[model samples]
Target: MPRRWLMAALLALVPAGAGATPVNAYPDIARAYWVEIDGRPAWAGNADQAMPVASLAKLMAALVLDEEADLAGTVTVSRAASAATGTRLGVRAGETYLASDLFSAMLVRSANDVCRALADWHGGGDDDTFVARMNARAAELGMVSTRFANACGHDAPGQGSSARDLALLARAVMARPRIMEDARRESFAFASLDGRRFSVRSTNALLGQFPGAIGLKTGFTPGAGRCLVALAERDGHEVLAILLHAPDRWWDTVGLLELAFDQARRNAPPE
Candidate 1:
C-alpha cells in the first residue's frame, strides 16, 4: 500500500468531531498538557510534572551524534547496534552509511538500529557514553527535570522528563533546520554499503493525519502508557502540544493539537 494513502485512510476513520470535546474533557483519565503558541507558553496543565519520555529521547541522541561526528561521515555498524529492537529501520551489522543518512533514520523512522549505530559511532562505542552526552546536553539546555539513562527511551526507570522540559527540548530541536527537516519527513530511504535499501515511515500519526501537523516524536511502554510531543503550524504560528500518560493516547493527542490550532487561529491578530 502507498504509505500516504494508508495514513490518509486511517485518518478518515477518525471522526471529525473528535476534537469537539472541551480542552480538559476526558473520562476519568489524568493528563498533562502544555501548549506554546507563537513563541509563548500559553496553556498548561501539570506541565512541570515529571513523566517518562520514552523514544522522544532520540532527539537528544541525534543532537549529540551531530555534534560528535560529521553527519556526512560514514558510520560502520556493529553487532550491538544491529541487535536493537522496536520500531527499527532493519540495519545490519558491517553495513556503512553516511552519518546524516543514519540521523535521518533516527529522527524520521525512530529506528532503534540507527540510534544504536549513532550511539556506537559517536559515543566511544558504548551507549553509556551516548547517555552521558544526553545528560550533559540536558543540563546545558536547562532541562533540570530530565535524566536520560539510554539513547533510545526504552522503559528504564528514571529515564524521563516533564512536559515543560520536553517543550524546551522541542523548541531547541525545532530551531535546528536539519533536524527539523528530518523530523517532518513522512518517509525516506537509506542505502547501505552492500547496496541494500531500507525505508522507514514516521511513527507520529499526527504528521499525516492532522492538517498542518509537522514533526516531533512518540513513545509507548507498558509503564509509560503512551506519550507524544506533537507539533503543528497554521497561519505563520507554530504550536507545540504535549500529552503524557493518557488513555486513548492517539486520539488524545489529535484532539489536543487540533484544539491548539483552533485556539491559535481564534487568537491570531488581524492579518
Candidate 2:
C-alpha cells in the first residue's frame, strides 16, 4: 500500500485483504498512474517520475487563460502560432480570432496552433514568459514535481510533469466550471474571422462512450505514448484517474475506476 495516503495506511490495520484490489492488479503500463477517490488520494504507481507529458501540458494553458487572460478578447495569430506543427488548428498568421474560440480550439481540438496563440497572447509577449507563469502556477498549487518549457506540450528538453502533480492540476481544473464545460464536449465547429471554417473532434474517448465520464483531457506523443486525465460523476460522487505513457489508457482508466468505486462502496457503512 502507498503510505502517502492516510486512508490506505489506516485501512492497513484491517485484515490483509480488506476487500481492496491491489494497485498492481490493474494493467498500468504507463510511466505513472494515480487515482483519487472522492477527492482523496487512494492509489498511485510511479507517481513521482517527471516524464514527457505530451499535450497534457496544455492544462496549464487552460489555467492561465481562465485565471489571467481575457477569453473574450481577440487574438492575432502570430508567425509562431501559424508555424506550430502536430495536432494543430492550421491557423494562419495575421488572422484575428476571439480568444475564447482559440481556447476551445486548444481544449476541444487539442490544436497546437491555438495553444501557441493563447500562450503568445497571454504571455503579453512570448511563450517563455507564459511558461514561466505556468511554472509559478504549478508552484502555487504545490505541484513540486512539475515544470513547463512551452505552452503546447511538445517534448522539450525541460518540459515534464509527474502524474501526482497532474492530479493536483486536474483537481484545480475541475473546480473551474468554465474549463470543465470546454473539456466535456465531444466536438465543436470553429470559424476564423475571415469566414474560414474548421471542425474538430475531441481526443478524449471517454466523454460519451464511458458512463458518467465528464470534462478532462488526453495526450499523445512518440515519447509520451498516451496520457489522459479523466473525471467521471456517478451517484453524485466523482472519480479522477490519471495515466501517463500508457498505450491502453481507455481500458486502464475504466478498470481503475471500477475497482476504486467498488472499494469505496464496500467501505461505505450501509448507505
Candidate 3:
C-alpha cells in the first residue's frame, strides 16, 4: 500500500474525542499546538495547520542521518556548510570531525554549520540530495504535513510542518536511543582533526528547569517565531507537547506538560 494511504488508515483508528480539548484552551499560547499523554492525543489547536518550524526541522534531519549515515565516519566541513547562517559552531571549511560529533552538535546546539556538513557528507558533498532523503523519510514516517527544504531547517518556500506531523516525527526520533541521548544532553564539546575545539549548549531552556524534561528539540526563525517539541516523563506517565510559532514557548510548554500529566493521573486506573 502507498505510504500516505497507510498513514491515513492508521490515523482513522484513533477514537474521536479521545481527550480532546477546546482549540482555545490556552489562548494566545501558540499559533498551533498539540499534546499527547502516554502516546494518546490529549489536547490540540490548529494541530494540522502547517507552518515554518525553523530548527525543529533538525529532528527529521537527525532521523534521516541516523538511518543512513555511519556516525563513526568522518566528515570534512565544506565551504557551503562553513558559511551556513543562524546558530553555528564556527567550523571552518576543510576541517574534519567525526560524524557523531557533528550529530551531537546539531541536536545539542542546533548548529547549522555541523548540520550542513553532516548533510553534505551524507549526500556525498550535496546537501540537496540529503534533503530529498529527508522528504522521503518524512513521507515514510507518516508526516503527511511535513516537508524538508534544507537539512539545517532554514526558512524557505514550501518548507513547513504541522504540530500533528511533528508529533509523529518526534515519536520516531524518540525511538532511536542514540538520537534521544544527544537530545538529552545539556552541552557538547568536541575537536576537529586539526585539534580546534568547539563547545555548544542546548537551546532547550526546559532541560534543567523543568522537572523530568528529557528534551525533544527547539526552534526559532523570524518567520517561524518560536517552536518546541517537549517530552517529559513523570511517575510512569509521559507527556509530549509541540508548539509552533509560540511567543512564550518555555512557559507555555511547562503548563501544557503539567496539564497533560495531571490529566493522565486523574484518568489512571486505581491501584
Most TM-score-accurate candidate? 3
**Across residues 1-271, which tens digit of lDDT does each residue of candidate 1 receive?**
4453344334433322322322333222236766666666655567677777778888788777656677888899979889998777778888898888899988887888888998888877878887888899999989988999889888787888887788888888887888888888899887886788887888878877788888888777666667787888877778787777767667656655665566566666687
Worst lDDT 10-window in candidate 2: 12-21
Scanning candidate 3 in windows of ten residues, the lowest lDDT window is 7-16
- Model 1 segments more than 4 A misplaced: 1-30
lDDT head-to-head 2 vs 3, winner = 3
Candidate 1 TM-score to native: 0.85
Residue 171's lDDT in candidate 2: 84
Which of the two, 2 or 3, has more TM-score? Answer: 3
Q: What's model 3's lDDT at 249?
A: 89
Give the clashing residue pairs of candidate 1, or none. none
What lDDT score goes with residue 244 in model 1? 77
- TM-score of candidate 2 relative to the true fold: 0.90
Off by over 4 Å in 3: 1-24
Residue range 1-271, candidate 2, lDDT tens digits:
3332334334423321332432433333467888777777666678888998999899888997898888989999999999998899789999988888899879998999989989998887598899999999999999988888888999878889998899989988887888988999999887888888888999998989988898698999888889999898876667788899987888767766765666666555675
Q: Using alpha carbons, what is the TM-score of model 3?
A: 0.91
**Each model's C-alpha lDDT?**
0.75, 0.82, 0.87
